[model samples]
Target chain A: MTETWIILGATSSIARAFIRQEAANGSGFLLCGRDMDDIAATAADARLRGAPMAEAMAFDARQPDTFAPILDRAASLSGAVSVAVFVGSMPEQAAIDADPAMIAGVVTDSFTGPAQFLTAIAPMMETRGAGRVVGVGSVAGDRGRLGNYVYGASKAGFATYLSGLRNRLGRSGVHVMTVKPGPVDTAMTWGGPKQPLSTTPEVVARDIARGLAKRRNVIYTAGIWRLVMAVVRAIPEPIFKKMTF
Target chain B: MRWKEMELAGWGRALKSTAAVARPERRSALAGAAAPAIGNRRSYGDAALNGGGKVIDMTRLDRVLELEAATGLLRVEAGARIGELAQLLAPRGWLPAVMPGTGFATVGGCIAMDVHGKNHHGAGSFGMHLAEIELIVGGEARPIGPDDPLWRATIGGLGQTGIITAATLRLIPAKGRTMRVREQRVEGWDEHIALLDSSDASYTVGWIDATATGARLGRGILEEGEISDASLPPAGRSRKVPLDAPGFALSSPVVRVFNAAYYARVPAQGRTVTRAQADFFFPLDRIHDWNRLYGKRGFHQFQCVVPPAQKDALRDMLRAIAQSGLASPLAVLKRMGPGRAGMLSFPMEGYTLAVDFPNRAAARSLIAALEDLAIAAEGRIYFAKDSLAGAAQVRAMYPELADWQAAVSAADPDRALETDIVRRLRLRDPA
Candidate 1:
């Protein structure tokens, strides 16, 4: 059977690489992004890479209703969604300091909205007795960083929600995965200061594909991030608070 | 040997006779004529069953084929049990890197399943250590190495490619008889993940009860340990279980109570150290029809590995099980090692959880649901313990399925060796 993957936030460079990889691996995909034109470009790229099928769908992560129709359309085209990759969310620091309206939109887009979208499609995946849901979280969610507490907190909530979703859907045959990518050099973090463990979108995308194929529950885009997080989590809170990133 | 006729899964009860087969010692006796072979029947699927075909039970072929301690390479007959090999090698300061839950499984069976153990997150599958497999392909015994395409096919081929007569396994130097075991109980799912995420041990495993709900859902015992070379001590020999117990033994009430107590006995706190054998590899020889406790219907085990990217998915899985009300008594979670090259191999660097459900009629749906979830996650089921996963799902889960099938087909075009599972999965075209 031809496996089908639905990529949320398809415009992201990492998501683009994931689409290319899946396409190269002979799988079909539905690319969903904020702009229809961007998704169309991605679909064209995926199709050129040898994807059995590739299509673009306009999506706004802030709007949960947009997902229902997209999911329906994917199902109508294919039998079911084999994998769903969510990579749409606002930057961490901006969401934290933004106005109440901006914060609400960030929280919804990052956590609540994705949760609703997942909740909507999770049943269909479960009822079909097979599917995978991949949520793109950040290493910032590992702990509250002073620089981006708001984005980190939202991602933390999303990561925690994915954990609960995984537990709920485990026995039903639906897999939910949370990806915690360390500092990735993407549009979201373009101007951000380069860190010791900053990774590229291609690297994160490869790790995501590998993690998805393995059905891993939580994956660090770069394996080193696991160790980095371990050390970060181990530092005494008093000591951690004094250190500047 | 009919699985349906024997008791299994640690309950010491007997199952009704759905099928039976007997192979006398004479039939299994090694002949000078190229050593005729048959697939190990331990496979849960039809890949091991040869419809009325003459099956030379390799279990009796139990003999040390080769052992090179200096090179850390040991070749043993297909019939040699893993427990037997462990006992033989443990004293020689060597041990198999990857061992499945049950030592009763034969070396060939391990290779067929590409079995993984608690240390899989670091050590990969049993097939990774397989230097080469000696197989009887089309009436000829040929040694296939890792580089050979047939090697990958047979490793996790479910015995579809050929009859594995012997295997040259890679062995690791043992540190000692003692193992420093540390046990801890995490409060919530997030903490549990954090704990697993943090630990780097030779062996690590978590036992959780899916029936536990709310804050207690993912709560369970986490045991992490490493071989204690400094505290080396002479190991004591173990006694074998000779026969099956009578029916009516190990009732559901008794098991439920025992399970409850076992879960309760675990202290809700940090770590404790214990003996290596007891900690890393206990219950070694409790293999007397352990599955009988589920009664006559038998049971199905759902084992899947969720990649780290999909780690949160496990929470959803746990919740679904709790809601389903299946009441799985034995649920084990562990971190798997890196991926292997076996076409149908189950290795994925991630966390794997295995749960057992009694073979009630409801179990069929539950198993199917679990399979679907695994596939959706892009996770594949362990073929060794699975009896119900459909062929299409299996193909979908394992991306290397087509490659493995092609290799097996190329190696044995005539399809000389066939089993019930191979037929069920249509591993080979119908003759």
Candidate 2:
């Protein structure tokens, strides 16, 4: 069957790698992002790499109004409609501390905005009755840590939303998979001290493809992250509150 | 653009430097860059490195903006890989006009080095196919076409003129996705040169056993290839070297045995076989990070092309290399025609010999000896493979160095795009 993917935040390196992999498999794409120029370049890349139909459209999470055109475009494509949410922003903790106002934008970018967009598109997936929804949460969401608890809390809420959505969408024969990737080597994680256990964007994309194929509900990119996160989640609240990592 | 501070190296892995890099994902983001640009870092030397400075990594911006199938005109971002381009265009009956040895080499790197291929004796260098370039000079993306003064300086100019944002490549027709290869074992230096000179194959190259000495010196396998209509299964999954190998993995004895085994893999009578185009063009890429096999010290490659009259001089260099007992299994000898496209392009009407050496004190001295031999023979060392050539000697090798430097200065008045190779060789200095 022909596949059409609606990739939100398509300019992310991870999203770009995923779309390229999908293009190689002959899927078309609706690359939605705020950076139209960057998104357009990715669409061109997909077309050259073998995507049948690749169109770039404007998408801004803070502006809910921008979501409708992308949905309209996705509706026009033929085949299973898949949606991948790679939209998110994490301001420096120091910046967020200095200006509490920045927290709203971060939460909007990382969580609530994409959730609302997916809610609007749920009916289309139901009408189609065959599609996948990949909501990219982060390992930071697995637990609230001192370093980036604000960002973590936003992703945690998003992950919960995805779980509820999975429960809701499973009945319609539409699958929803939550991806909690560890430190993926991307622009998102560049320049900082290297993560001891980090995987490449390409590897993350590969694992996502595998997870979707198996119809997995939730997955950790490095697999080891599942064990690592389990240990972290198991920590007692008393000690966790006193610790800073 | 996220500016990441990290240590990076050339393909050789022998030389490394810490620098700041920003990999922009779009052409628009490439603006306002006061730095050199790099793609793939496949130059094997400092040509792609900008030490203690800032540089833009173009790999992420790779995209094919346009293609005219009939005219074979392809407009692609600087970071697009050559082998990927071939894979996309081959079934459609088109291929890059020239591809360097590695499939991982990006289009921008090829143009920066003006790289040659096995078909160099016929197809010339990669820059010859360039139609136009989107060059980012001092924050502005300007189009430099064939008629532009900056064109020649940008081509094979080691990323000195500007950041090449995009380029138009004139692809050639490919008969099929596979190539028919003819292999023969050359007995010695004399026969190797004879076969390379006489061969009529569109793509021709010889694998020399740099460890061979005495009568067996320069003995190795010679391969001639031509594209065919035969449809074959695509190349298989590439394997990677998981860890840095021990230093002795490619010791002289090991290299000798490996070379002998490799040479003997071909039947004594010679034979014809078929291979996927990728395998034929980039035989070593199948093994990812093959350089690590030389250990953490990394390796250096000495590649030079001497005029036809200096064939005897080349033999002495080879003899010295064999006697030094420092050669690795990787060595190549090829006949090149005088069909280069840039001022400092490596190809010339001569025999080009490339031999890899594990980074060691003795090997460095041996490489210096080879450099002296090349200069004495009135030959030039390739910028893409050189890590040790002195500025004065290299300046003498390429007569057009002054012309190239002048154009580069005019294009980049502040020298914002000068790379480590430029700084080391003092390429901009007239004297």
Candidate 3:
């Protein structure tokens, strides 16, 4: 059976690396993203790398109108129709503080928008009774810090939603994984201050593949992040509120 | 991110640069400025560095867009590694026509340097296999074909003719994924030259012991390989150089012992062995960050090509290196065909010698003397490996320098694509 992956936010660095790895495994791909040009290039690369089928489609997280065509395309394909959501946005805390309106876009791009798409496609995945859903969240979501709490809050919501989705879909033989990675050396963190123990997109992709193979739920990349976040989450609310990262 | 400030260096670690770098991951993102673009920065010296200016990092843009199975033509991005391409295509019975010594060398860097491989005697330089190049000129993509004069300037032009976005390469049909290699010991300079000159294998290379002198001069191993479909165990895991080695790690006595053991490793009668294709081509790559073996002070590699008639000049140069007691274990000598695709391409009908030396005052002076000898013999130094050649001496070596300069100047009037090597050698300046 051909496993067709409906990759959301296909232009993200981690997503691109993940797509390359899967393409080599002879998987099919429906690459969806805002930048059609970039997605088209990745599709061509996937085809050359041994993907059985690869197509690019327009997808904008802020607009729900773009989700149906992608879901319909996945339904038209045979075999397992999996989806990996790498959609997220991180505007500087200072920028969000200046304009509160930016908060909505952040939440929509990271949480509500992807959740809506997944909610619409859930029945299709359940009917097939075989597929994987990989939702990429950040370690920052484990405990919001002063640096970028809005973005952290969005990922936190997405992570929580994935936990519920996993419970609902696990009964039907589908797997849902929540990946909480620390700062990855991608465009999101490129020019920012040096991130502690920051890993590359390639590393994150490899971790995701390992997590999927093991059928693990809620795994932390760079595994050190799990311990670090554990200590952070244990801190008392009063002290944590007064401290800054 | 659009840009990031960082310090980078070439493979030799002898030259450093602090620049604002923008690593665009997509073709659409590469449409901005006509800045100098660098791939894996595999050049041993400053060929890929631009001191305090801006540079475009093309490593992330690597991808193979298309492969025509019938004609064996591959349309690939500039940042794709040569080794990765071979690994991807070999199982399908095709390979990039020419691959440099290190598989980590990117397609763009190979084109800019006109790198040669063990098959240089037959397949020629990397640029000779290019069917078309999608070069970013004046912030727009333009396809450059063989008939265009810019084509000559771009290949081996040292990235001065604008950024190379992607290219169409003519891949050759490969027999299999493994190699049948025959290794033999050669004693004395005459036998070494005789063996290299007479070899007709698809891939041939001579590993000379740079520390040997007198009656044993030029004694080392010669490896000739042919692709085969033989089954072999998977290669072992690659090891990494954890830290900088001490100065004595490659000292004269230590290197001599290592060389003797390496030479003796091959039986006195010689033998044929099977090796993975990558293991045969990129032996040093097995040790990740092998450059750290040179220690913190770094090292320099002196590579030069002299016409077949100038054998004595090369021998004298080697003798000088042997007496200096500064040579490292990495040294090579090979015969090249008269096949070059650029005005300043590095290949000619000659024998090329390359030797690595720790960055010391004595090594610096020895390399300078060798450069002068190369000039006297009408030979040329490889810009990709040189870090100390004088500007005027280099200008005299390449007769077509003026023509390259004219084409490059016309392509980049503001000199936005100039690199450290281009600036150091004064390649764009007319006498």
Task: DockQ each candidate and list the results.
Answer: 0.00, 0.58, 0.72
RMSD of every candidate to native, in Å, equals 27.9, 1.7, 1.1
Best by DockQ: 3
The weakest ten consecutive residues by lDDT in model 3 chain B span B25-34
DockQ of candidate 2, scored on C-alphas against the true complex (2 decimals): 0.58
* Order of candidate numbers by TM-score, starting with the best: 3, 2, 1
Q: Write the per-residue lDDT of candidate 1 for residues A2-97, one digit (tens) a residue.
A: 778888777776776677667878888888867675566567556645677888877777766688778787667645476555554665465556
Candidate 1 has what TM-score? Answer: 0.57
CAPRI tier for the interface of model 3: medium
- Candidate 2 — which residues are off by over 4 angstroms? B231-237
Task: For model 3, report DockQ.
Answer: 0.72
Candidate 3 ranges beyond 4 A from true positions: none
**Chain A TM-score values for every predicted structure, listed in order:** 0.92, 0.98, 0.99
In model 2, what lDDT does residue B175 have?
Answer: 83
Clashes (N, CA, C under 3 Å) per candidate? 65, 0, 0
Q: Give the per-residue lDDT digits (tens) of candidate 1, residues B1-431.
A: 21112211212111111222222121122322221133334444344454544344466444454567588888776777886667666756888877777677788888877888778877888898888898777656678997876888888777667767778888988867667778877666887788888888878888886677798878777888777655645556655444543423433455456656777776766656657454256454444544544556556677888788887777788877766766557788887767574788887877787877766667678778877888788777877667677777777777776777678777677665555556656655422
For residues B1-431, could you state the per-residue lDDT of candidate 2 as single tens digits?
Answer: 67888788998899999889887766677668778888988888898788888888888777888888789999998999999999899988899999999999998989989999999999888999999988888778898998988888888888888888889999999889999999999999999999999999999999999999999999999999999988676668999999999988999888889999999999999999999999999999999998889889899999999999999888999999999999998899999988888888888899999999999999999999999999999999999998988888898799999899899888889988878888888998788
Candidate 1 at A10: error in angstroms?
70
Model 3 lDDT per residue over A1-245, tens place:
98989999999999999999999999999999988877888998999888999999999999999998998888888899999999999999999999999999999999999999999999999998999999999998998899999999999999999999999999999999999999898877877888898898899999999999999998999889999999999999999999978
What would the DockQ be for model 1?
Answer: 0.00
Candidate 1 residue B373 Cα shift, in angstroms, is 1.3
